[model samples]
Target: MIRHATTADFEFIFELYMHPAINPWLLYEPMDAVHFQPIFQELLERKVLYVFEVAEIPVGMCKLVPEEHRSAHVLYVGGIGIHPSFAGNGYGVQLMEAIKLFADAEGYRRLELSVAAINEKAMHVYEKAGFLKEGILRKYTYQKAEDRYLDEVMMSCLL
Candidate 1:
């Protein structure tokens, strides 16, 4: 189940965010808990973060940001990640479905996201969830630690 995250969920959320298998694809640079706390708290206060639970245990998280421009019909999926231990069990698909449902319920006309070009696994999951490749964002994301730029694929699914 997907629901709004609370401050109490911080420890689990931190683990998910900094997991070795998941953090590389995330937009934020890896940092210690002390440094990440402020950002996480901000996200919660902004009310854009949602946590996915399996049998009452948090297993994943996602961000849904509503577009504020003229195209208010679009909702951007900022990021989504399942715990590595729960990966490959269709949880990603479930999360995508939940995002789509949330978008539709919120009257969004499209759901958009950008995935790192090298993240084939996530690309496949997005494709299976009905998102189509819209374009390539050349050298769109920079990895501060690695000192490299990574290409990203822009994708969207009409709601």
Candidate 2:
């Protein structure tokens, strides 16, 4: 089930974001609770954070930012990750489906997201979800820790 995340899911959220296998793919670096709390709180306040649960156990999450600007009628997906234990269990697909339904219901005519070009696994999932490659964003995301830039693939699906 995909539902709005709540403060009660903090431990699961923190653990997932801090997981070595997942953190690098996330939008932000894993910080100690002192720094992470405020960012988490802000996301909650924005109401864009969602939790994916299996058998009522939190296993993953995704953040969708709605954009209704004149040039874009889309929902931007970010901070998507599935716990390592839950990977390849179809939970990711379930999460994508839920996001699609939510976007459609909310009148978003397009869904947009970006993935690092190196992340082939995620690119396959996005394609399966009906998003087409828009273009490559050269040096779009900077990894401060790595002190290097990564190419990003911009993708979108028309609802």
Candidate 3:
């Protein structure tokens, strides 16, 4: 099941956010309870975060942020991640489809997102969901462990 996230799911979401396997691709540092509490509270209030549940267990999440600086007709997918245990089970595609449908219903003209250049799996998933490679942002994000920069590939889909 896919549904808007609630404050009650914060613990599970935080666990996933701090998962070691996900650290490398994350743009922000791992969250402690102090950091995540307020964010999860805001997410519940804003209703912009969605989670995928398998038999009532959270498996993945997608967060969307409206493009306020530009036109309201565009929505940006801020983040999408699935638990490593669920990676090969097609949950990512299901989550993408849900996002696309939600965007269409909300009258968004386009959906935009960025993926780390080295994340081939996520790029493939986005491409399969009808997002096209738009461009690249050089040194877009900082890689903490490597102490270097990483490129981000911009992608978009016309809803």
Candidate 4:
């Protein structure tokens, strides 16, 4: 099942976000309950966060932000993660489909997301989801803890 995420799902979401398989790709350090409480609350109020479950077990999450307040008519998809145990099980594709359905129903004309250059698995998933590589932003993100830079690949799909 794919559905809007509620506050109760935060703990599970945090666990998935912190899973070892996800660390290298995620932008932020693993979050704790306290760290996610406020953000989850805000997402719930804004109707932007989504959770995916299979057999009643939470498996992944995706967050989308509209660009009305920004420079484009695009919707930004951020922070998509599947638990390590659920990776490669097609949950990522299902999450992408759900996002597409929501975008189409909301009259959105484009969807955009950024992926780290080294995250090949996620890049492949995005491509399979119909998103095309737009360009790469050199040293787009800095991992302060690691004292290194990461290139970001920009991708978008026209609906």
Candidate 5:
């Protein structure tokens, strides 16, 4: 199940965001809980972060930010990650399917997201979920820690 995140989900959300297996592709740099608290709070306040669960146990996370006015029918998906422990269990596609349902229910006509171009694994999952690659933003994401820039591929699934 997917639902709005609560303060109680801090730990799971943190682990997923900071986990070595998941963090490189995410937006935030590695940081201690003390540093991430404010960001988490902001997401909560915006009501964009969501917790993905299995039998009430938080197992993944996602962010859905709706566009406004001219693009109101679009929902941008970000911060997507499945707990490393649950990786390879086919949950990624399940999570993607659920996201689609949620977007449809919310009346979004398009679901969009970007993935690091080199992240073939994630791209495969997104493709399985019906997202089609639109284009690549060359050297779009700079990883300060690694002093490297990664291309980001834009993708969208029409609901």
Candidate 6:
């Protein structure tokens, strides 16, 4: 099930965001839980964070940020990750399907997201989920730790 994330989800969200296998592709730089709290709180406040749960356990997370006015039909999907422990269980597909339904139900006609060009696995996953590669945004994201700017592949799915 995909549902709004709440304060109770702090640990799961934190663990997933900071996981060594996942962090580099995610939004935040690695940080201690103490430092992540405020950012987590802000996510809660924004009401865009969601959790993909199995029964009662959250195993994945994503952000569904809707655009306003003329672009209101678009939902920018971001910060998506499935726990490494559950990586091969088809959870990623399930999460993408649920997000599609969720966006459709919310009146979003377009779903947009960007992946690092270096992340072929994720690009494949998004492609399998029906998102088409729109173009490449050169040096779209900066990896401060690596002292390099990575290209981002833009993708979108029309629902």
List where candidate 3 sits over 4 angstroms from the true fold.
54-56
Residue-level lDDT tens digits of model 3 in 47-152: 8888888788788987887877567899989658899988898888878888898888888889999999999999999998999999999999997768888899
Per-residue alpha-carbon lDDT of candidate 5 for residues 1-159, written as tens digits (9 for 90 to 100): 799999999999999999999999999999999999999999999999999998888889999999999999999999999998899998899899999999999999999999999999999999999999999999999888899999999999999
Best by lDDT: 5
Steric clashes per prediction: 0, 0, 0, 0, 0, 0
- Indicate the residue-level lDDT of 15 in model 3: 74
lDDT of 3 at 97: 84
**Runs with alpha carbons beyond 4 Å of true place in candidate 4:** 69-72
Best by TM-score: 5
Q: What are the Cα lDDT values of the candidates?
A: 0.90, 0.87, 0.84, 0.82, 0.96, 0.93
Per-model TM-score versus the true fold: 0.96, 0.94, 0.89, 0.88, 0.99, 0.98
lDDT for each residue of candidate 4 in 1-159, tens digit (9 for 90 to 100): 568888788787777666767755765665677886776688789988878777877888888888875545689998799887777788887778778988888788899999999888898999888999999999988877578899999999889
Clashes of 6: 0
**Residue pairs in collision within model 3:** none
Candidate 5 stretches greater than 4 Å from native: none
lDDT of 1 at 50: 94
Reference-based lDDT, residue 101, model 3: 88
Pairs with backbone N, CA or C atoms under 3 Å apart (clashes), candidate 5: none
lDDT digits (tens) for residues 9-92 of candidate 6? 999999999999988898898999999999999999999999999887888999999999999999999999999989988888
Poorest lDDT segment (10 consecutive residues) of candidate 1: 12-21
CA lDDT for candidate 1: 0.90
Kindly report which residue pairs in candidate 2 clash with one another.
none
lDDT of 2 by residue, 129-155 (tens): 888999999998887878889999999
Write the number of the candidate with greater TM-score, choosing between 1 and 2.
1
